[model samples]
Each structure stands twice: as C-alpha cells, then as structure tokens.
Target chain A: MKARVHIMLKTGVLDPQGEAVRHALGSLGFDGVNAVRQGKVIELDLADGTDEATVNEMCERLLANTVIESYKVEIL
Target chain B: MKARVHIMLKTGVLDPQGEAVRHALGSLGFDGVNAVRQGKVIELDLADGTDEATVNEMCERLLANTVIESYKVEIL
Candidate 1:
C-alpha cells in the first residue's frame, strides 16, 4: 500500500521560501503571480492494510508540526 | 487560476531526508515501512489564462532542478 502525506504551513503563517520563489519568478519575467505557498509531500510504502488512521497518527506524531502546519493523508 | 507543481527526486536518486524520516518512524515504533520519498509541492495563484505551458516553463527554468528532479504540473 502507498500513502502520501501533504504537509503545509497553516494560513497566516509567513512563508519566506514561497515569497522567495515568487520574487524569482518575477525576475524571470513571469508576472501576475498573486500568491505562492510551498509544502511537503511524503510518499510512504507501508504494509498492506496499514489504514488511514495509522497514517494520520504518523502525521500527528512525526510528519507535521501541528502548531503552525496542517497535513492531509491520502491512501492508495 | 491555480496551479500546483509537485517536484520529486528522480528514482535512483538518494533521498536522505526520506531515509531519515523512515528511521525516525521506526524509532517511534512504526514498522513495515518499505520506503519513504520526500518531495515538494508548490501552489501558485496565477492570473486567469496563465496556461499549463507557462507553468511547465517555470518548472524547467526555476522551480525544479531537472537534472535530478522530475515535476508534474496540475492546473486547477
């Protein structure tokens, strides 16, 4: 089974990296890029039947910093 | 328009960050994790009609290191 965790900073948190990318794009002549947000995706190959709850637990315990970030788990 | 670029290290490339996460998960008692791969997701709020080709250009020129990383762009 494969599971993916998408971790993103919570709205209202400052994202300097995203801002940097937006700035760089402007320098490269791409304009009107209103907003940019960067996040992390972790792909996991887990034992079959691992379940979504287990993946959620992993995110809460290790994959995300709940204080300033949020995560979504997808199982496939 | 919204665009999402998912950038991942090419297969056969070493991903130390993913390995570190796997090790940490094991130390925390999560087992049977066959593999872990870490990647980046960049979300952009672009002008309407920005088009997919523009996003691909962004990936090739700036957003991704094409030599070692592959990226998928999704327009939504």
Candidate 2:
C-alpha cells in the first residue's frame, strides 16, 4: 500500500521561504505571481492492512506539525 | 487564480532527506514503513488570466530544478 501526505501551512501564517520564492520569481521576470506558499509531500510505502486511522495517527504524531500546518492523506 | 506545483526528485536520484525521515520513523516505532520519498509543493496566487503555458514556463525556469527534479503544475 502507498500513502501520500500533503502538509501545508495554515492560512494567516507567515511563510518567509515562500515569500523568498515569490521574490525570486518576480526577479526572474515571471510577472503576475502575486503570492507563494510552500509545503511538503511525503509518500510512504506501508504494509498491507494499514488502515486510515493508523495513517492519520502517523500524520498527527510525525508527518505534520498540526499546530501551524494542515495535512491531507491519500491512500493508494 | 491559483497554481499548485509539485516538485519531486526524479526516480533513481538519491534522497538523503527522505532516508532520514524513514529512519526517524523507524526509531519512533512506526513499523511497516518500507520506503519514503519527500517532495515540495508550491502554491502560487497569480493574476487573473495567467495561462497554463506561462505557469509551465515558471516551473521550467524557476520553480523546479529540472536537472534532478520533475514537476507538475495544476492551475485552479
């Protein structure tokens, strides 16, 4: 089984790295780039029968920083 | 308008960060974690009417390291 996790900063949080990317894009002549927010994706190969609850617990415990980030999990 | 870019290391590329995460998970007692891969997502707020071609150009030039990474662009 494969599980994919997407972790993103919550709205209203300041993302300095994202801001830097935005600035870099502007300097590179990529106009119309108003804002940028950066996040992470984790792909996991899991043993069979690992349920969604277990995966959710993984996110809660390790894959994501829930205080300032939101995460979504997709199992395939 | 919004564009989401997912940048991932090309297959066969060495990913030390991903290996570190996998090792961390093992030490944390998360069994059945066989393999792990990590990537980045960049969300961009763009001016209205920014077309897909322009966004692809952004990825090709600035948003992704084409030498070792492959990127996908999603416009919304």
Q: Write the per-residue lDDT of candidate 1 for residues A2-64, one digit (tens) a residue.
A: 998999999999999999999999999999899999999999999997989999999999999
Pairs that collide in candidate 2 are: none
Question: Each model's fnat?
Answer: 0.92, 0.90
**Clashes, model 2:** 0
Q: What is the fnat of candidate 1?
A: 0.92
Q: Evaluate residue A8 in candidate 1 and report its C-alpha lDDT on the 0 to 100 scale.
A: 94
Off by over 4 Å in 1: none
lDDT (tens digit, per residue) of candidate 2 on A3-61: 98999999998999999999999999988889999999998999998898888988898
Docking class of 2: high
Best by TM-score: 1
Given candidate 2, what's the lDDT at residue B12?
96
C-alpha lDDT of candidate 2 relative to the true structure? 0.92
Best by lDDT: 1
Ten contiguous residues with the weakest lDDT in model 2 chain B: B21-30
Please report the interface RMSD of model 1 to 1 decimal. 0.4
Q: Count clashes in each candidate, considering only residues at least 3 apart in sequence or on different chains.
A: 0, 0
- Residues B9-69, candidate 2: write the lDDT tens digits: 9999999988988898888888998999999999999999999998899889888899999
